[model samples]
Target: MAHNALPRPSSLPGIEDLRRGYTPSTHEARQSIEERSKQLRLEQERIDAELDRHIAEMQRLSLRRRDVVRELDLNHALLAPVHRLFPELLSEVFIHAVQDPFNVQKTDFAVRVLCGVCTTWRAAARATPLLWTFIDLSYITSLEDPLLRLQLQLSGQLPLTVTAKVQDQAMQLLLVAFFDGMSDEDASRVVEITVEDDGVVLSQLRSRHLATLRVADVNIWDTCTQGELGFLTSAPTLHKLTIGVQYECEDDDAALAFPVPVIPDLPCLTHLILAIENEFPVSAFLPAISQLAPVLRVLKMSSFEVSAWEETKPTVTCEMHVLHSLELQHYTHRFLTFITAPALHAVTLIGDDAQLGKEDPTESLLDLLTRSRPPLRSFALHDPMQGSASALSGCIDLMEGLQRLNIEDNERGVTSSPRLAAVLQRLVCDENTPPMLPELRSLSVQCRGDKSPCVHSDVAAPLSQVRLSRKDPRVCAGRAVAALE
Candidate 1:
């Protein structure tokens, strides 16, 4: 072969370069293998470093995620079981769990969260049309039309729930919207409607399944005007009716008159609470009660009026049946004039002495107990007016099945700053007229403030807290008496 033009058969281009000047020997080959091994090691080290950094970053991210979770505000959640999942039931539970009225945003968020849980839950949540039932008309500037629109919208979906706070004009319009939204076909879909205001406009809301209706802060002055109200023909499904009547009238008789009360026959009614004041006319309710309510099991009647005489007859006559609990708050002399409940099982009387008249409130209370259906199982007498006493014998005569008796403001006339220690010894403390209460199981006496302001300032001022007797041997059977000095 010519010098540069010819190449040896064993000398290939790439193979000859690998071999270089020396022949392919074991040691040389070993060196090449070692170099390749070193390169691989370097690459592995770089990869290891990158992996360590990546791991550190992942750990940091995890820590940040945990921190975020800790800072999150948690709402009350009923940890339901995963097995039997019912989204609508969960939503109902959440509705009641939301005790904070202003947390409507949270409520909406909860509904969304539940819907996002699973497909089955989402379907269930959607199925319950009443799930989104809430009325918040706190801002009453453009109330009537806006509220009416909202009411109509809610009426279209499922049953409606009315919850809002508005004053005079807005309240009237809200009432109108409520009545107007109902269809004549059936009222069963309307679940619950609650109103918290002192004013009310009589509207005919005859629902089929409307279970509960409550109205708070009822003012006598806000009743139906001469031509404003006639008759409420549709509110027959109301199971509970709570009315707060603020007394501003000097004449009790005229104040209590209802413009027109044409109540429908309602047998499902069970509970009635009326806080009438300033001479609210109970007679006006007669037209409604005579035809409307029949089965009342719990009746709570109170009046802020001192001369609310018109309600006495009805308060007594209307309340004489199947009552299990009775709470008489601020019992004016007008109620004591001729009040009676033959079926009352539990009686609670709460008021200051100033609200009472010359008659001993205890005697009047005992008189009712005698007329009650059976022995009052629970009796609470709170803070009677000054010089409070009922011939202990006479008061005990009222109860036939007395199980609990709670007496508050037991301090008599000792705050007059007189040295009647002898009288206190003979007629008060030492004069234990033997326990006449046979079946009395629980007795609690709250010796807090006195009826007279003088006594309260001087004597009752020191008593801030009193303890209840628990460890007594007769906890269940013995007459429980709580005495505070």
Candidate 2:
């Protein structure tokens, strides 16, 4: 063959020429390619459809977010007009909102929100009585004139039991407002009036409506307490009165300054607790108290007043039908003569030191318990053994119905306490915690002795005396019995 010559191509085919010249090899191969092309085209159409669906879902979520924002705007929008139209509604809103005490704890947001609505809201807030129902002068420094009007309205028909505690300011205005609400008619409804203020502001005025009065922790450190008690006599219905007085600038000869409010003849007093700070001339009061508190069930005293007279003969002329529980702490001899609670159920004596006093009072106290109205169930006397177990042992049968009993002396140990325990051993559980008490289900004993087992071993049949500590000889005996069986 001669040397072959080839023609040189001028350029590559254009996109249009390539498209036109494209061909399939066979019918089957052409069908396979056409099917693949149709699949690719359909796949691209499906991708576009999915994109459109995702865009619709995104639009829906955005519209929902806008709706929530709009609702929030509407809800917050209603409050402003409500406060303006009905100004009293501001205080009412506070009354309803303050139902949750936590709302008023740190910041009274609900209160301020209502008050800040407008000037009319503020005026209505000042006038509304319910808003000032509980006067927490704990935070108030300045007084608005309407405070008195609000207090009177809030008191309504009920007599006042005003319990106020103020330290910083002269709470005289607050007291005036409170007392103004009480008419002579409101005296019967008053249950108690307790005021704890500094600087002896109580000396400024007197009240007549109170039935029960307790004034404690007044910061007149040098103020005499005895005369101050007289100030409480103004209350006509007052039966239970407590005064905590301080004696300052003590001139032994100087007479004490106090209010002399005439204490009414209290015929209905059932309980009285008197705490005199310094040496008070209560000898004058002894006859009066006895005559007045005729039906008195409980009488409590402190160490200072009644220490003088060893035997204060308290006449039990009135019927003590409802006297059951008696508690005496730091009592002196004069207080003891009045200890005739004929109907006493339980007696707890704390801080009675005969060692310091002139007389040994163990016998008199025991006599009081034995002569009580009913059988005593639980008797607790501090350092009881310091007196005599024999005296206390006499009080066991005071109450046949008394099932629960607790006797504990932190000072006494195994040797000293066992005497009392022996007397109370009737309550002990020998077999399955003495089932004698069908009414008494549970019993506990905390007093322990060193030589004695921290807990006594359970009684097993006659053979096994000690089953708890394995070292007990009863274990060997039990094993022997088993072998024989």
Candidate 3:
């Protein structure tokens, strides 16, 4: 392209006189100077006009260049490898890219990002029903919000896992609408539900195939009546139930008023977890387990008030014939006296070390083992309040079939080193007696208290002997000794 050359002023009328600093003393000379100044002003305006035109032209060309680059980039993107991928494969990629679709707080952003990528990706995302199956209405601001409806619609007939935090009246209304909008078939496709209740009576989950239900409440005073939870009784396929409640009891007498939520008999219920916060009398809830799901395989309980059972012994004993695993926290060995699990294989107990005066759980554990004679393989005891060496050794003597044993003394009290050493010594086999745990494959002893030299020296010999006897010895000692293989 040919460009026009900018014009320059040839010369000033009195250029030589002005350079020489000649004064315009006469009227004619001053008049002549004024005329030249006027001409110069006219020329300057013409030059500025020309510059403006060229500047405008350059800007126009720059915009055109940008448009051309964008077009080329779009064309190149169309030929990319990802564009060649089948929609089905791309949908799977989208599914993996989005982590925890049920967590609306995070997955909602991911879904939006995937949809905003391109028309093809948006179509693939909408077509993938699995991505939309988790309909979280926890933060739904308005009933008119289309995201919730879109999720349900795109999910189609696939099984849904719904989660909602019913914090206010608006959220409760949305939750109701969420269920009301669903067709009978769509409702039946709901397999799992997690609801955090805040004194709201939730719409009964009407799914016949409902397998898991997790309900948590920060306030225990707002009780869910049996009538409110009547839907659980009809949910025959429900296998897992988790109820977490935070109770604020003012006094010991308040525990007497503790209301036990109606837990309906779920015949197929296999796993049950009750996480109760704050101090509530164990008697208020423990006895009810006898009538819980008969075929329950796992029972985990936490944060229960450990009552002095010596003063008031529990007459009622819970018999769980098919229970395979049991875990309890903030409890004494006395609590074990109230339960019997014959099929139990794993037991984890986290004792309240603050209550150092409590009786050792060794006898209670021995009693339970003798009573049930379960094929116990794994046992983990953490911070036992009054764990004695003799008591622990006696408990080990009963568990000849134990495969994994983990004992942790976090307090490192006066008895911590001797207790750990005694347990290790009990594991050693001699000429007179048979091995304590012949099937033992893993032993983990952790003492967080002061490390006594005698502990390492005493347990080292026993640990070496035990390792020599076993084909695969995996012993991990924390702060006391190094791991042995």
Candidate 4:
């Protein structure tokens, strides 16, 4: 390689006369200089011609080398073990390349790429129905009929997962492609469905054996008035349901425009999450959720108003015996007063003072605790009432199994500043207190900055006493709230 890179000895001529600055002083010297210059020019031209010929030869060889290398690669690929595998085995490899069918997006379409690779791969991909089972129609909102038709045809008899974003303006196209495209048998094969859009309805949900349905960031307008959403009432196999609605319209009009909801018994549902952006009546969901109480293990509701549920009240107060976790935000205590959960252990209440104080909410919550008598283990209250000391004491008295307690941003009145201090002081000092919340393990309190300074010293005094007399409580305090004490 090194020898080939260097210029040939005859190709380079040394300019010794020029370097020595040999001036032509006489006629003979001038003729000798001209003859030498001419010889050098002739040699240079010959070298240039030789270089051009070598470059042309190198180009020809390089093309031949590339062709040989390509042929070798092709032969090696043909001999690979993967090529010998059965078409079914190759189809499995294609499925693995896709990773997860449910979460696939239009941009990273693995099935389509696999089909376009070669004739054999295309045949394998086309023959495998599972590879095309999950169809993401989110990007093709204009209802590109060919793609939908291809997906449906390829999916065959396998269970399908469908995801789409049906915009309000594109409802007709979505309906024509998704709703009208499928026969009852084809729709029944659908196992999961997700829709993210504004004021759009999917009537086919009623006919399908869907197990998971998530309709996120929706604006339910006049479209649901056709009773298309009644599928949620009788979806016997549906296990997980998540619905998020943006409420920016008149409440009564929106309620009336919505299809009259009919929530029947759901025996298989384990997870239910309902989130409304604005204040829709929490009572509106009672008809549906009451039926779910028997089987639900986790229930979360966020951002809703509370009003009377229906004119014909339920005669029996449904008990949620299986419900273990409950999370609520921007909700009133009226909901607690309505239902009872005996097996409830974890509870999180996130709200402001007004919502807690609405309709004398503390008493309602206390009554709920008294009635349900849950083996309460974990409790959290966000921005609770000013008089939380008494409420905390009462809760501890009722729930002897309580282990974790979390409170946040308690800054309402003069008494509120020392609420934590007072609760601890009574628990440690009072002879008759009997070690309130004896099993307490973790206590977290976050107070307003202005109040913590004055309250810190008061709370600190009981730290040593509580530790000496009883087991140490894991105390976490912030915004100047005293630790341990």
| Model number with the top TM-score | 3
Error of 2 at 309 (Å): 10
- Candidate number achieving the greatest lDDT relative to the actual structure: 3
Alpha-carbon TM-score of each model against the true structure: 0.55, 0.49, 0.71, 0.58
Model 2 ranges with Cα > 4 A deviation: 1-132, 136-151, 154-159, 166-169, 172-191, 197-204, 210-263, 276-288, 300-322, 332-334, 352-364, 370-385, 397-402, 411-420, 426-485
Residue 279 local lDDT, model 2: 47
Residue 109 shift from truth in candidate 4, angstroms = 5.9
| Tens-digit lDDT track of model 4 for 193-310 | 6665434354444344333332222234333433434455535677767766553545576556323344445568788777755455566566678777878888887765433332
Q: Please list the C-alpha lDDT of all candidates, in the order they appear.
A: 0.49, 0.47, 0.66, 0.63
Tally clashing residue pairs in candidate 1. 15
Query: What value of lDDT does candidate 2 attain over all alpha carbons?
Result: 0.47
User: Ten consecutive residues with minimal summed lDDT in candidate 3?
Assistant: 475-484
Instruction: Arrange candidates by TM-score, descending.
Output: 3, 4, 1, 2
The TM-score, computed over Cα atoms with residue i paired to residue i, of candidate 4 is 0.58
Let me know the TM-score candidate 2 reaches against the reference structure: 0.49
Each candidate's number of clashing pairs is: 15, 11, 1, 0
Q: What's the C-alpha lDDT at position 308 in model 2?
A: 31
Q: Which regions in candidate 3 have their CA more than 4 angstroms from the true location? A: 1-84, 99-107, 142-144, 176-181, 199-228, 249-257, 304-313, 332-334, 353-363, 384-386, 412-416, 449-461, 471-485
**What global local distance difference test value does model 1 have?**
0.49
Residues 17-128 of candidate 1: C-alpha lDDT, one tens digit per residue: 5667655468877798688879989999999999999999999999999887755622212243642545556556645544457766433443556466667665655554
lDDT of 3: 0.66
